[model samples]
Target: MLLLALLMGGLQEAGARPNPQALSARIEVREHTARAILFELRVRNDSGHRLTLALGGRPAYNVLVKRPDGTLIWEWQRGQIVQQILEYRSLDPGEELHFEATWKLVDARGRRVPAGEYLVHGVLNLEPPETLVTDSLRVRVAPAKRRRSAK
Candidate 1:
């Protein structure tokens, strides 16, 4: 998993360097559960040009997630997993735009995730969605560990 991340880091760096209006993303997850988890994704306009971003038809921002193998984890575009899209304003050159949202993690049957190791990713739905999905962003989901006392 670390190796994959390393390779992606290099690929993503190259992707973000070329586009003047491109969007770069970094995600930090506070909690992980089948129901939902708190996520703070920082988006920046690394290019030399300033850009405007929107989420759910507003001057806001949202987040999407997928598996490392290119499986669909969750998406705000269809309002499938998450309840609503987090909002944000414009992003200036080299400026940071913090996008916070609660991700609704579910199993194959739409059931909340149990405890386990899963690789969840964040999708940046830029005006012209990013082409480098694999290289864009990746996050790991560490299912909350529960301790049991001996009887």
Candidate 2:
């Protein structure tokens, strides 16, 4: 009975979820101008061995902007075309990969958004083991200044 219990316990431990510290995702935002913001999404491989990631027929990463009240403003994948092919990449230990996009302070409808504080969310989707890592950052957009008419 002791041997049987020990075997079962070993099997259970082997099937447990991967350690959360094996991978990490982070979002960085910087003001490009009074009406423009730059966003960067970074994914890091923290494990000792090389990690393989498969991102299916979609963008490898996604970014979304929302108001403080949680109203969705714009999404990076709204009008993107993703080839119907499986994409894969390998990351060495302590290596990082990044994706970037710039927002012109406009809404999905092309209208300029009001100046205020907004939340930027980013996600890195990995396959094979099917894991999702996410991070967020806050940004402020300054109102555009108007030029006075020449006398």
The total number of steric clashes, by the backbone 3 Å criterion, in model 1 comes to 4
How many Å off is the CA of 51 in candidate 2? 0.6
Question: What is candidate 2's CA lDDT for residue 123?
Answer: 61
Candidate 2 accuracy as lDDT: 0.67
Candidate 2 per-residue lDDT over residues 27-96, each given as its tens digit: 7874477777888887777767775655555566778899999899998777888665556677787888
TM per prediction = 0.50, 0.78
Going through the candidates in the order shown, the clash numbers are 4, 0
- Prediction 1 global C-alpha lDDT: 0.49
**Which residue pairs of candidate 1 clash?**
34-112, 34-113, 60-88, 61-88
User: What does the lDDT read for residue 113 in candidate 2?
Assistant: 88
